[model samples]
Target: MNLSLEITGLTKSYADSGFMLDNVSLAIPSGTIMGFVGENGAGKTTTIKSILNTVQIDSGTIRLLGKEMTDRDTALREDIGVVLDSANFSAILTPGKLAKVMRGIYRQWDQELYVRLTDKFALPMNRKIKEFSRGMTMKLAIAAAMSHHPKLLILDEATSGLDPITREEILEVFLEFVEDEHHAILMSSHITSDLEKIADYITFIHQGKIILTAMKDELIYDYGVARCTSDQFRRIAEGDRLAYRVKEHQTDVLVKDRRGFGQQYSGIMVDQVSIDEILLLLVKGEN
Candidate 1:
């Protein structure tokens, strides 16, 4: 498979907070949306910053579009579109002026596409960015990101403030972006429901460590959340167990192979799991 981004042993540490990205690694394939998820302060933003070369790492290598990322690689940087939690554009500039500024920055900036997207998103061109709502600012960031005709997109909390309908519309645009085999996206959001709807692969991090990386369907369907009594939990083999939590009446066990476990223990109940449920169980449950 052709990879759009690859990180190996990507590690970073903060002096005061003691937060560390401990040996993080993942691969994002072309034409796929990779949902980067974790709780706050779990290194999701740190990882993205490292990938963009904004944060210096202690040790590791990052490869984007088959080339190692370097601070001076303007060409490589241009191929990647990045949208952060908050855009840093001057509050006084209108979207129309921002477009002109962006045109000078990106070699491949498409003015026509920018106008179309702005219209599609229903953003006011004449209003200053500070006057725009949270949703409008986010939409404008997305419009700028897409207008660059980038091969890769990196979005951090891009969907957090938008209403469900707007989020759905933006997600459809993401789907269209990756319709071509050469395009890819790495998106990090607390909104797991949105990720569930659009992401092809899900990579989950917890406390600065990667816990799981798997296909969305496999994580959702093949993995099982088994509710069993303490006695029944003891019967589950160690190799099949991923994580488990004790509830008031029973134990919730996350099993690697739901089908195999179901077939092995005919009477046991193996329930389907959502991305959010799985994340909760992994982050809060016992191994």
Candidate 2:
């Protein structure tokens, strides 16, 4: 199927409050970059953890590179590179020593790529990890993840604190990684601007549920931000495809079926929405 990852009927929860994820399903095709978009506490990280088997699932199935995923026997994981917010390196070790430790852990680790990336990022090899700044630490994590040459890369907020130049450099690396037509990525981040530049698909989650998911191009082309007075909003929003809505003296609406909405609401102004605008309207709305 050329699909790199799949999740079906995935469910997870805390003790008594509510489900962190509920019957969620996701699929990422090989060579595609899928952006996992959500606000804080929106279950994006939980879903990623479930797929990686770091957390147990209540009832569901996960397949990575066409193999069923389980908590034990992480052989499939060896083919995947993961970067979280923190590097997970020993604070006392130097970058060179950390490289050796990771090489021992992954059977397919590429030492040449590791060395090249270290040089490319211009990381100081002898400095302790604890001494590195936040941006430098993020670069180190990227270097480690790319060193393994994995088929799939899963990142959770990997670019939260980097400067513009560093973020652009990382984006270039991601672009180069997908050039092979066999690699894929699932990146979770609140920084919508970064995702807009590189992601091919977008998924939005709010309040522990998936609000929308689709190709990035289609989202930009088809969905729209509609602003109107309160009376105009009421008259225009009474449709099946009104994906979501927010109300003030003026209102913003997200319509997935843009053609249908356009036909129905000829009086309202509908403009193309960016990833950030879509996220803002969805997360900030009153349900």
CA lDDT scores, all candidates in order = 0.93, 0.85
Candidate 2 wrongly placed segments (more than 4 Å) = 16-19, 240-247, 257-260
lDDT of predicted model 1: 0.93
Give the per-residue lDDT digits (tens) of candidate 2, residues 1-287: 59998888888988876657988888999999999999889999899888888888888888899988766656778889899877678899889999889878898889889889988988999999999988888889988998888889999999998999999989999999999789999999989898889999999988778877899988888888777767777786456335446454667777776676777888877788889888887787643
Instruction: Give me the candidate number with maximum TM-score.
Output: 1
- Please give each candidate's TM-score: 0.98, 0.93
Best by lDDT: 1
> What number of clashing residue pairs does each candidate have, in the order they appear?
0, 0
221-272: candidate 1 lDDT, tens digit per residue: 7999999998889898887789999999999999978999999977789999
User: How far is 7's C-alpha from truth in model 2 (Å)?
Assistant: 0.6
